[model samples]
Target chain A: MDRLKSRHLQIAMFLLPALLFYAVLLVYPVLRTFFLSLHEWNGFAGSKVEYVAFDNFKLVFEDEIFWKSLKNVMVVMLLSIAIQIPAGLFLALLLNGKWKGIRFFKAAFFMPVIMSATSISLLWKFILYPGDGLVDGLLMKMGLEDSIRAWLADPSINLYTVILICCWQGLGVVMIIFLSGLVSIPDAIKEAALIDGANRRQRLWFVTLPLIREAVAINVILLVIGTLKIFDNIYVLTDGGPNHATDVLGTFLYKEAFRNNRFGMASAIAVVMFLLGFVLTLVANRAMRRESLDG
Target chain B: MTNAKVLRSSFMLVILAILITLTACGGNKGNNSSSSASSPAASSASSEAASEAPKEKVTLRIASAYTPDHTFGPAIAQIIDEFTKQHPEVTVEKEFLPVAELDKKLTADRAANNLPEIFIIFPGAGTADYVKEKKIIDLSEYLNADPDWKDGFISGALDNLKFEGFPGIYAAPIGAYSTGFYYNKELFQQAGVEPPKTWDDLLAVIGKLNAAKITPMAIGASESWRSEHLFTALFYKWNGAEKAKGILSRALPYSSPEVIEPLNKMVQLVEAGAFSKNYIANNYAAEIADFNNGKAAMRYSGSWTVGESTGPNSPAGFGDKVGFFPFPYFADKEEHKDSWMGGVSDSFAVSSRAEGHQKDMAIELVKTLTSTASSKLITEMAHDLTAVKADVDPAKSGKLIAEVSKAMSTGKEFSGDISAFEPYKPANTKLYDLTQAVLLKGITPEKAAKQLDDEVAKSK
Candidate 1:
């Protein structure tokens, strides 16, 4: 009993500082947001905060724009997981080599990932701008005038424009993760697959992919969360304009809290977003697990 | 190591990480210049004051969105310098936040219970709210005590900033500005067109410009604010003050003729190719460049553009080519025929947080900055309208800002933006969105107007 007590005491001492910070920073703010969501608050310190129960949540439900934002988030999330993840993995596989320029290509592809979303959005805005943009100008010069697009200004393509920029900026992280996982795979296992007459495609689809289940799962989960919470790209590029057609949950929450001065509504949106992220992560993990097992 | 040892080690590392994070966060908070009054100047000034005579020293932090290059920036600096020189007992620390970041910084500091002792307040909803919360000081007592100061203020200037049914004034008026069509005079001359005398004249000018192959007008709706401001010029011309009041009072729906009429005219402009080609994708940078280089005949812009167009900010000879004109009113209506959209804009408000001697010092700072002398300086340098009546010669103000400033004075009455009015505050953002939808997305004006009315109803 005394030895057991000593072991427990040792554990508590090591954990106390971390627990304190976790509670203060992350846990406390989340709980505070939940509490604030239950009231009607203007977000001003001295302003009267009224207890409105679930009225804020009711307001959120009635917000058509908020729902549109969630739908936009879903579109971006699907693109991120379905398209971006595979694209990243494809790049990782292609670039996983010992060559003079392989490292250079890898570094170049990852360059945007290190830059801020605001700068990336502005750069793309200039490049994608119709009539005057580099892309459109080049197309016009090449007599591909029909290919010209208003890019971020058009309602139909603006959200996708933002999503693609996000993918371009974020591709490096997924690629780097997959590259580390690929490089870590043992030579023996790959040799064994080759000895069994497995070709490059078969080895990739069978042995190499199945081996990196953990990496794919992690990357997918990360992309889903990031896509759902994306704000900076939308803010700098479109600002949820062209008739709120490009609004995402993050921008919606920000508009409510900062611009509209409705903190309660913003908090409710935050909580709903949190739940969506949690459930989606769980679902993604399950799918990845099942797929890995099947492989 | 065994599994338990590894687990224990990782947890210990987590503890160490958390400690470092906590310390870092605390360290960061200590460095929060957001709420700090810059000290060195105040310290040195106070020491100098201490040498002269032992007086009860009161240090006040003054904050503003004005950069030193802004219209009133030099006047503001002069006020602080002169005040400190006169009263050695007072040390005023200045915090200069650019206009874009002022609201965010103010709110953050307000939440922290550490707002600067005096600050420039944006004119609109939040100003009223701040007054109600006692964050802003009531300035009527000071104004009333000094009839010179009271009479010196432009009529309706302070009253324009007052909260409804609230006693006294909460802000001191600094200046006024307007938004209108800033055209290239040389382009108009080359095209053999003068400034439009009426709405039809304006359209004819646009037609002539187009016939001459000069891009008739430049609008960068990609930026959105340009569109909203253009909507401001159109709406205020049609709605005027009384109709605007009626719409806000709910006596008239926004869908009424007053709104849809102007909305339709804007649509007409777009349909006529009066705006730049690919205007939907062209932003401020492109619009300004095209207009400055004479690729376009005109661009709808505001008073601030006058200073930039004529001052060092403009391209070489851009000022020489640029000219401003008020948006034309209805062809038939005699009433409000010369009415233009603009009114008493930016103001300085003392914080209620300051008490006793601190409050007195703050009030003195406001008086010095807004005095007639300071107002004239603001007019001549910044090319803005002074809220205090001052004789500003066109030659002194430069041709462009001077012309607009003259228009601001001669206009029948100053028509303010809908959002700046108290009742329209709740629906301001929705109004901007509605304007964007109507103009950019090609939604029907009637539908957009009704949507705005519905937004107001819902908010109520």
Candidate 2:
């Protein structure tokens, strides 16, 4: 009994630091945001904080900009999954072979993933700079001058431009994730598929993709969470501007809290974002799990 | 002993070690915090003693948005160096943050009652907020105590720091600037047009520039503040300074003809394509680049551009060919022609909590920072305009600087950025957004004006 008590005490002691850190860093902030969202605070230290329960959330829901930001985030999420996943999977398959210089190809493809988002956004901004930008110049040289549009300026198309850059930056990570999953699969499985008269496409569909369910699940969750929190790239590229044509929830929350000094309103946005991320992640994981089980 | 007993004893020893470590850390933290808490008071007391005994030390911390790479950085360093040389027993600790970050940090510090001894403050609305909260010390009494120092500041420069409803001057002017057009004479001549002197003249000039295939202006409407700057220029031109201030006091609604008319004229310029191609897509850097590279005829900006344009960094500087003109006035509003937009760029403020020797040191630092010699050095070194009167040598002050100095000096009255004059931060942000929308045709001028009025009313 004495030894059991000692063991339990030892376990508690071992867990205390990590638990304390989690509470202080993560739990405390989340709870504090929720508390703040229920009040009106201008984010100044000496300013009056009034208890205005649900008012901030009500305002957020009523805000057209908030709805616009949500729609933009959803577009990004949908496009990221549609574009990045297939492109990543294709690249993974292409580089999975033991061809010479495959490593170089893989590294080149993965380069953008390692670079900072701010740098990527800046680089792309330069490349897509209007009138004399690389894209316009290339189009003009190709006799496609009519195709050149204000890539980061036009409200109608700037969000899509941002989505394209995001897809480019995100492709490398998804490809690497799929590559790891592919490498871990038993070689015998592919050989068996081959012996069973499976074509390249058939083998990919029947043998390889089924085996990488976990990676797909991870990629989906990561892309969803990433798109929802996308700020730095959009912020750097356009600052959610040309009239906030690219504002995501992250940027909107930042503007509310820091720019407008409405911490309560920003906290309400954050809470909504958190709940949305949590629900979407759960739904994605569950759907992925169900498919895996069916397979 | 048994194995279980030995294990238990070892576990107990590990727990004892951890407890001892935690307690030591806690004790050290307590001592550090307590010492830090008392250090300022102790230093002030020591400085008071040092006046009598002559060997004690005083440390003063100043926070500012001026980084070492900024033009003002070297000027600030010189002032600090001069001050420290005069007072060997004093140390001035500098905390430099970017402007946006500094606003946040200052707000946080004010809440905690832990502001640095001195800090840079935005001249109008930002000063008003700090003054309203009584977080910053009023400088009126100190300025008045020394007649020479009070008179040293340029006429009307200090008034820019004075806010309505605030009883005292909350800040001392450090830098003064005004906004207007910075145009390339070569481009104007290429288009066979002179700098516009009135709204109708501006339209005629724009037509000629467009005919000559020159962008009449470069506006980075993607950055909403650019749109806000244009709005201010138009508003001040048509309505005059008094009516502009009336909007701030809510005596005039934003939706009133005085405000909406300017918004309409701005939209008309957008429709006329006065700005660069895809101007709404361009950022501030792109706008400046267009003007600098001679791709555009004019760039609407502030006096701060003089340093960069004349500096070695400029690839194709116009040198003496650069000319500045205030935004064209309304042809009919000749009475309000002298009303220009722009005033104090930034100011230095002392903390209200600062007392005794610390307060004395802070005030002395401000005086040193804005002294005639220091202001002249800043003017020559940085091509900056200071709030204090400085005799700028035209040979050292480039053509653009000299011209801007003349324009600012001759201006009868200055109203600051209209958006910046709003004490409520959210309304200020909304005004910028509405201006951007209006410029982009996302909303009509009438709608934008109504929205601005609604936002201000709601914020109030």
Candidate 3:
């Protein structure tokens, strides 16, 4: 019992710094934000705060712009999960094969992921500009004038344009993770699947995908979190405008908090955002856990 | 522990320590700069007094939200140099922030209770809120004693400097500007259309231009503020002065027939292809470029465009071609035809927390920068249309400024933008979005009007 207590004390000492950090950085701010959300005050407009008791949250729920932003966030999440996952996995599979210049392709594919979001957004904005832009110029040259439209300006395509840019920038991490997972799968398992008369697709499905389940889970969660918190891309590209059609929760929160000076409303939006992320993450984790157990 | 394990643990500890130290040092530097910037006037005054005996040097820090090339920068530097030269015992350290970042930084400073002794106050009903909060010092005491300072300001400039139920001045006007339509004279000539003298004439001109396959106007609606400017312009025209003021002050509903009339008109114009294709995506600079490049016949903008059009780096023919007009009013309403949407005062307020000599110095700085001579110099250099009555050479000042001045003289009343003059509870963002939606085909004028009404009702 004495030995056990000593060991426990040592473990607590080791964990103390992390606990202190979490308390100061995360827990404190969240609690303070909860307190602030109950008051109606512009963050800097003196101390004439009126305690309205959940009015701010009620206002957020009733705001049409808030609902529009949530829809945008959902669209972005679906695009990231549906498009980015398959694209990244395919790239990882291609890179895993032995081929000339494969290493160079791997490095090139990862380059955009390491670049700053602002820089990438700016580059893509220029590329997608309507007139005198690279894409438009190329289309004009090919006598495809009908095909050219102001890609970023069209309400029908603006959100998708932003999603495509985000997917391109984030594909690197997903690719690298899957590549590492693929390498870790024993070559003998693939060989055995092939000998058992499994086709290429069958081998990949039966042997490779099962082995990379943990990597797939990590990639999905990372993509979800990243997409949920997306700000810089949308901010630099559209600024949630052209009629508030491109607004997402992050942009909405920024406008509420900074521009309108409605700190309470911004916090409420943030709290809702957090709850959505938390619930979705739990559901994903459970599904992945069940999948692993079945295998 | 094994040797490898021990070595790895030590490496990890060192890395962690370095990270902590870096973060702490970064945080400390940020805090130091902010504190120094905030309390500059106090520190500068104390150091000046300390150096009166000729024993030590004095240094001052000035936080400015103007870039070095901006007109305010040179004006500020000149004031600081003059003040320091008179004292002979002071030095100023200046820190500048970009214009776009100014409001955010000021908001943060205000929240922290660490505002600079002197700062720019955005002129609007919002300034009233700051006055109510006691963030700004009442300047009536100072202005009353100085006749020269009081008289030098343009007429009606000090009206916005007042707080509720009090006649005392709390801010000073640096300059004045008005928004209006800028049309290409060459385009009008080429299209064989006369310059518009009324709202109907303007619509007729737009119709002619659209028939010729040229967009009548180019506007940047992506930025909500830019879109709001057009709404304000139309509101002033459609609702007339008294009703417009009532609407802005929240005494009238946003969904009133008067408010919806202009939106319906704007939507009709959009359906007729008055604005450039994809106007909602273009930025302010890009829209300006579009008009300058002859792709659009007109742009609605402020007097700031004068400098850009006539500057040395401007595209060829812009200086010779660009012309200005007050956005047309209804010709049928003869009594309101001359009333122009304009205002005096780009204002600044002193922080109330500043006291004694620091406060005195800030007031001195404001007076010096806003003096007639300084104002003239800034106006001429920036190609701005100054509100102050002064003899300026038309040939030297350029045609745009002359045209604006001519209109200003003939104008009967100067009505300010609704959002700028009064506080409506739902905020300007909703109105701005509604206008853009009309322009972008996202909503019909009737639907937009109803939505505005809903927002106004809900907000109350």
Best by lDDT: 2
Model 3 clash count equals 0
- lDDT per residue as tens, model 1, B1-460: 5557656766776667666776877677566533233343453465455555546689989778677867567767876788899999899888887764686688777765578888888566657777766677678878998887777778878877777768878888886777778899889998999988677888899999988888999777776567677776776666666566665567877778887887888888887779765677777767777777778998777687777667655687788888888887767764667667777777888875565566667788888888887777777777766678776767877877767866766687766666554254336777767777767755899988877776676564
Instruction: State which candidate has the highest DockQ.
Output: 2
Tens-digit lDDT track for model 1 on A35-112? 989987877664678888998888888777888998999998888777777899999988998878997899899999
lDDT of 2 by residue, B1-460 (tens): 5656656766666566555655776587566445434545574686576556544566788999777756688788988988999988779999888765787788677655678888998766656777776667668877898888889898877777776777778778878788888888998999899988898898999999999998999877777878888898888888787777676678888778988898999888987879866787787777877877888888888887787677555665555677898878887888778888887777888876665566777889988898888888888878867788888887776778888877776667787788766767877888888899898888888887776776676673
Clashing pairs in 1: none
Judged by whole-model lDDT over C-alpha atoms, candidate 3 comes out at 0.75
State which candidate, 1 or 2, has the greater TM-score. Answer: 2
Q: How far is candidate 3 from the true structure (C-alpha RMSD, Å)?
A: 5.8
Question: Which pairs of residues have clashing backbones in candidate 3?
Answer: none
Q: How far is B85's C-alpha from truth in model 2 (Å)?
A: 3.1
DockQ-based ranking? 2, 1, 3
- What is the Cα-based lDDT of residue A293 in candidate 1? 81
Q: By how many angstroms RMSD does model 2 differ from the true structure?
A: 4.5
- What is model 3's interface RMSD? 9.1
The true-versus-predicted C-alpha distance at residue B172 of model 3, in Å, is 1.5
Tens digits of per-residue lDDT for model 3, B317-351: 68789888888877666566666667764566777
User: Which stretches of candidate 2 lie above 4 Å from their native place?
Assistant: A1-4, A126-150, A184-189, B1-59, B68-71, B97-114, B164-166, B315-317, B353-358, B405-410
